[model samples]
Target: MSRSLQTLRRLALPAALAAALLAGLQAARATEAPVSLAAVALGEADYQRVNDALVQHHVVPRYQVMAAAMAALDAAAGRYCAAPGAGTLAALRAADEAAVDAWMGVQHLHFGPVELFMRSYRLYFWPQGRGRIAQATGELLAAADPASLEEQHFRNASTAIQGLPALEVLLYGEGAEETPSAFRCALLTRIACNMKAMAADIVEEWQGGKIDFARTVAEPGPDNPYFESAEEATLAFFQSLYNGLELISDARLKPVAGASIEKAKPALAESRAPGRSLRNVVVNLEALQGLYEGEGGPGLGDLAVRSGADPKLEPLLRKAFRLTVETAKGIEPPLAEAVVDPKRRKAVDKLLTQLVAIKQILRSRFSPATGLPIGFNAMDGD
Candidate 1:
């Protein structure tokens, strides 16, 4: 045979073998049974318990903390703007860090009142959108009159300049601390005040008598517009849990870690300006664990156990969560730095693997135990 023909035969044989292997894998996946948790039955009382525990232990407390933190941040910004001193600026930065930390803790609760007014996006716009935050914030600082930095003006301002991300740029970006212009100081106070207002609004909506979302979850009825039944409410909670994991895995970690070191995109890490990317992940996992274990209240695990879920499933899942958090905590600060380093990158990759394992357990075991429908899209935009 000709040399070219010989080379073609050699390549074709391996290509055919690879195609057969892929076909076999696809067939194996196709034959697998659909996951089902229908065996786990829950009554109205059980639903009420789960809902009440979640609100009492998870939702209300976290929002309250965030509101307090934002209020402190607003006060610090006001003081710093008024004084423009070294001590005050340092205090403002501290307050900013505290508020952001509080936000990371509650960020996983991506439903209810926070979604109504676009508060979540307003509170923290991520991915930076190729420096939209910097542009909008700079413009606001340059053009905004000190007197015009009111609540209404901030409400009407570009969403990019209304939240924590913009504040970070103003506080930590170039010449921000050393020689903050009067307009920049005013803008900082304005953003902090706006964040406080948004956080307060979320707490009010959740606790308000006019439309208490927590009550709606706990007491589902025909009158309620949001949840028609307890099961639907429970499913929504499960979706939140699942979506949190999805976000941590797909959005937060995957983008920074990438498929391999050569493809790593370290700059994509959330809250990179403040060097709290790993800290954010740690808090996020803790929040997910709280939802799973119910933080000493009736949570998904309790419901699963009560409804005949595998007894070992909850313990195993808890172990996985704890290990993931521990692993995350070990990673150094500024995930941007860690994402590019060989040693730290391996640690992050390991954590990602653990998160994926936890996700699988939730999909294959936890959901099946709780009667959470298989193939249900837990994420938004699905």
Candidate 2:
């Protein structure tokens, strides 16, 4: 409830052999009660636990942290716009990175409160091209009054210029640290403020500002527009996990790394201007991993094991997730540079390979265990 940044701070198995290549550490999971395969089905009560742990512990907490981080960015923008100086610019850039990191943490989620106003895409639009960013940036700066950036106006503005992508255009790159243009400053502050607003709205709605979207997700009913059954609600999180991973592999990893190292396209990398492209996918993997494990409670993998799947599937997923994160972190240079550099390019390739391996493992084990049908994404890359 407090505006203070400190107050709101509440914060996969792979193929098997290949996953062990990175972060060679093993994770231990607590033992869960056994349920026979005959009873593998999730009843209304079981679904409630799944929803409660995911919504209350996983989704809401992450959204609150994102709001706090965006709030910090807004404050930093205000401070710098008030007086442009090298020190202030440097502080602002740091805040920008922090905000991007927070967004990355929750970016994979695309349902519930985040869907209220299409806030997710507005907060962080990616796969965006440089020309579009350039044009959007130019148009905003060209405005005599910069009126389009007004809170009410940004809502109607093209999403291209609305959030992180546009913010990167104005806040980063050469000479970005040195500034005097009044229009550029105004644009930066507005984007930051709008992002802050979106983040707050998401957190509030999830916590019941407009509607307890989290509870709506948790308790599905015949009359409920969101979900008809608790199992359906449970599947939404599953879909997010799969879809989020696919987005990373397809959108984030595929475009930059390209099919072969020889055809790399660094320009397409997300958040690359701030050197957060690698960090972006890394955070995404970590968050998706959290979703796989149920955030803090009985993750799907744990539930699968209890539901009569191989008990080893849970740890296998854990190992796969660790390896993927370790592999991504292991990349020496950021994506843009690595995609172009010959020697380092293989590291990126290996990361892509590891990511696919994680997905394959999920398809084979996690899906069957949880009893959730394999969706289109789960069937992808097959």
CA lDDT of each prediction against the hidden true structure: 0.77, 0.74
* TM-score of every prediction relative to native: 0.87, 0.86
Q: Which ten residues in a row are the worst by lDDT in model 2?
A: 3-12
Q: Candidate 2 regions off by >4 Å?
A: 1-39, 173-175, 376-382
Ten contiguous residues minimizing lDDT sum, candidate 1: 3-12
lDDT tens digits, residue span 5-44, model 1: 3322332243343344345334433543232234466677
Best by lDDT: 1
- RMSD of candidate 1 to true structure, Å: 8.9
